[model samples]
Target chain A: MLPYGLVTIEDRVARLLTELPPNPQFPTQGATLFVDLARRQVRQAYTPRRIIETFLAGRGANMFYLYRLLDESLDPIDPSVPLIFGSGVLTGIVPSAARGNATSWSPESGVLMDSNAGDYFPSFLKMNGIDHLVIYGRADAWTVLWLGDGQVEFRDATPYLGLDNIDMRDRIATDLGGTWTRDLAMANITRAGENQVLTSAIMAGPKACYARGGPGAKMGSLKMKAIVVQGQTHDFETAQPYKQYNKEIATKLLNTSVVKNALRTMGTPFLYRPSRVLGAMGTKNNQETTWTDRLDAENITPYRPGMAGCFRCPVNCRPLNQLNDDQADRYGRGDGPEYVTLGKFGPNVGIDQVEPVIRLNNICNDLGLDTASTGSAIAWAMELYQRGIVSKSDTGGLELTWGDAELVERLLFAMSHREGFGNVLADSTRAIERGHYPTEARKYCMAVKGLMQSDPHDARILKAFALGLAVSTRGMDHLRNRVTLEINARINDDPGFKAKLYGGPVSAQPNNYETKERAVRVCENIYGVGDAVGMCRFTTKLFNSPSLPGLEEFSSQIANVTGLEFDADVLDRIGLNIMGVERLINHRLGVRRSDDTLPDRWFDEEITVGAYKTEKIDRQEFDAMLSRFYAISGLSDEGVPAEAWRQELELVLSGPA
Target chain B: MSITVRLPTTLQTSGQDSLTITEPVENIAELVRVLRRQLPGFPAQWDDSMLNFSVNDEVVLHRAEERVLASGDVVEIILALSGGTPVPRSAC
Candidate 1:
């Protein structure tokens, strides 16, 4: 049980009603499709923002992300309750407006969480006229929710139980009628989800995936295989009225932004060498920071097929890796070997071969496993083996050695198939806690809450990211606040822009823990705007680069698209409101000061690498930063939001039903 | 005088990570001549490429070849496509 586990649903509702403003109509309007599997009933509820505020209270991405958290599903560990898929209000209305959220109680974190993906899935859902799809109750057997233009059908999914995500997609497509249509979008989990692996990731469409949190395991428990939505014969709705103007401006901005275009050209593999060069690559489960430059971007470019982007996104950062080699003959090709996978599977696990890296990436995609968590799991085990904490006997006679890409490949399959040693590894953080590793080995496990760390940029190097991961509602996530990634030369060189960006140039260093909390706070608010607005952070000017839009620029863009007359201040308030809901959800899930912390390794030890050879977080300084963070968030010392926060935001929480 | 130029993956076709141009060059054409001479026909690869040059973090997006370099100045020729780190999958 959680420390705040006793915080009941009723108590939460009462607190919500106490804190929220009087019921006001939501800024946007849409129909919520509610599906009750047990009752065999599907209902549509036109819940305006006022009613949503009474119960959940949010605008775009925040509402979908936080609503499930506000109720009994707040800490859903194999919950028999509800799971929701929410599209942002402006989803399908702009380029790169392709992210939809799988908002539910995560089996990984045991709290209200979201696993988000960018693709045409959200677009198709919007075209189908549904903003949110809420699934609850239990089915007697395996089922698939065939959600089309105007109809919902519950079909049996028992036949596709053991197939991998790729195969399942093909089978489902054939079942729905053979030819692939541009109109359909599908999300499914493979055997990993079926076995309820803690790191199960949901694969959406063919390439895009919500690759964090084992919410797929929740679907596994429900005996649900996939949720496929097809648009009714019409093309995806365009952002009309201002469609041409919006596209022209957006295209101009995207075209002019060298960063955005570079991503589309090089894909994410470009960061492999640079990350190591910068000493930010998490090597050997973060026991080391840098590795040889041989495995960098140049090595991986040989296998590129072209660039791949999300449905509406003009920026294609996912590199399409096409391999015709013998192993590639087996694993074939897919989108990635992204920096996270390349970082973890490459340096984090001590492997460097680009071919194996690409293969490992495809393996995870097919199995519907989260590469970040899977790589971390293997790396942790390898660390244990390196220290004699775990033996070959423990790993079923397989040597858990570093740089053994083949072994890593075997371990991935083992976990996916629940094979001997894989079963032990698949148990997640508990595998270590349950004495799988020597208790002393816990310090090296680099996890926040229960989920494994996304290991490209180590927290010791990036303090803002460290704090962001520690407090993010969806466990340790980088995308939750993309601003921390902007400790680049651009910010370092320009003091005027730096002053406007962070506090000033003096506080802009990655190692500057004093003002890092300020950056994190700023990033959290603006990223919330992106999530709520359905825009990707990479394109945003606030977090990644100053060349992009800030609050005022974004407000104008929203106005241009939705015809909503929101300014920077209004948008900032909306962002803060979204963040408030997220914090409260985490709070209700039993998050407190103790949980809002980092592993001892980060605070106690200095990074042993280039540039940061003498760097480590000052524990006292970090604590003060935390205090400042809470203060900036308008929360108490305990991280509880002040009632004044609710009053100012006009949040009126509804009591009971 | 040695001026260091960091070669991105696209420009590093010869597997050289970085090139140090000791010969003096005044303009982009001179720099292109040096590159063509050094790597032999590599400058032709620049056609249809969205490449930009940066001198000590200052992006000289236009006429970078024509841009003058100071002695011991660090220059980065980045593929305007994948400019270091923008958005990685699970961007940190």
Candidate 2:
């Protein structure tokens, strides 16, 4: 039974839902959906006049966009319990919108975790008249939740249970709605999630995924199949501010020569060759960082069908990779095999072939598993096998050898089904746990705070990236700020810009440990702001160092979209607040200075590649750098936020659950 | 002292990691001209607009001919491996 006496705000188009305080302690605004089997309701009660103060702009985007700011009120959102989803103020409207967080308490790390994915659902959701959906309690049986024209419906989903993503998509479309004719999207769960696999992702679409923590399993536990969002791209005249704002990015992406050609032509797979040259890829689970010969555009091109884009995005960086007979025999074709997939499965796992790598990628999508974690885990297992720590007996009678694609496929299948050895690889944190390994295997695991490392860019080569990987709030993610100033130090900026932005040298060489702390601090702040505002880092030149969307333009985008006053300074403060608040959340979750360090491999082992040879995070220097960053972040010596800073961000206060 | 000029993956000569100029070259222009006569397809994969030269590790933004190179200097034709070719940062 749904909670009775639920204050309803059925504006229909712009619904604001709130959970009734079981204890009347925590006052939550930004739409938190609470669902039960019997009925679905939107509760926008407890409208304190002071709640308007909480409204940064229109319930901080009608209690949608700036929802993550409501994190303090909505802490301990058990990912094992409620399957929650929320959007940003300008999610569906902006052309560069690639983010909207799926906030939940991680079953893997037992911390607050949010997984971000791009396109489709976020945009059309607005037109259909829904901000966000938060599911509470369990459904009686297998169910499908559909949202259309401001109405929520639940149908029997017993028939579609245990189906793969591709087949599931077609079946879901037929059952829930019609074809992909409308701009409809859903967060689809899989068998991996149903079985409580920690690494399972809620499939965002066929290609992309809201992957990180086990959101799928959370949905599966609820006996829910998919949250079908039926919405359309609204007309231009209805919201002139939105139209003008969308045009700002759409026009730039269409006309600008800055980001054209490369992404469109080769997509992200083009990075393979250069990364090989620099010897910067994490090859064979970081035992080696470079590949002598690996798949690049030349080999991967033969499989490319065309370009793939997110909802209304023109700078589509995904290649629709098709499979041949032998390749198709193992697994059918899919949209990506993105750079992350390529890196994780290709060089990282020791497979140089593009076809099998692509197939492995498809299998990840189909099974609704995170390719980054799954592939990295497989690579880690392969290394263990080589060391004789893992044998055929433990591997379920298959050899865990490097560059073995067939074995990779078999292992992924097992992982999805949570069968045999796959169960061990499912939870990264468990593997990191002492004595969880067959032998002394915890040291070999390349993860930060239980979450798997992203992008596979060897941190040994890029120092700032290493810092970010060490200290990222969520986990080891590159999107926190794709630190490329080190890569393009000379080509990008001046002493003025550098000093103004990061208070560092203009030609801040990638090798120099100096000035990196400042650089990383600035990058994280901006990226946090981008994440908060639901801005896509790729399309907009946010942290790509001196690129597009300068301060004035950034603020104008916010003001234009929401009719709120924002600028570079305000954005900086917002980012700082988010980071500070995130610190408090982690503080509550037991993450401290001790957890804010890199893997042993990064500190002990030198990068055995030319140009970056004899490079590793010097422990003494890194320790001091972390201290400097803490000071800059207004945190105490122990990486805890100052009491004053927490109060300023309203994090010191709390509400009841 | 003679120097070797190296190229990235896109511009490197087949089966060669670098091109060594034992003959004396005065500047970048002289090096480019000599390389054109010396190597096949020297300018085929290059565009004047796209090529940003790095003498040693420092970026050479303008007047490549004026930026003289003596012996033991490594000249690298800078181009992004993926896509970001070095566009000039406006003279400050």
Worst 10 residues of 1 chain A by lDDT: A50-59
RMSD of each: 6.3, 6.3
Give Cα distance to truth, residue A314, candidate 1, Å: 1.6
Which candidate comes out best when scored by lDDT? 1
Worst lDDT run of 10 residues, candidate 2 chain A, spans A1-10
Q: List each candidate's DockQ score.
A: 0.09, 0.16
What's the lDDT for candidate 1?
Answer: 0.66
Q: What's the distance in Å from true for residue A466, model 2?
A: 0.8
Error of 1 at A134 (Å): 1.5
lDDT of 2 by residue, A306-399 (tens): 8877766667877887786555363666788877899999999888888788888888988999888888788888888888887888767878
Give the DockQ of candidate 1.
0.09
Candidate 1's residue-wise lDDT over A594-634, tens digit each? 77777777778777765557666677887888888888778
State how far residue A219 of model 2 sits from its true place (Å).
Answer: 2.7
Q: How much lDDT does candidate 2 score?
A: 0.64
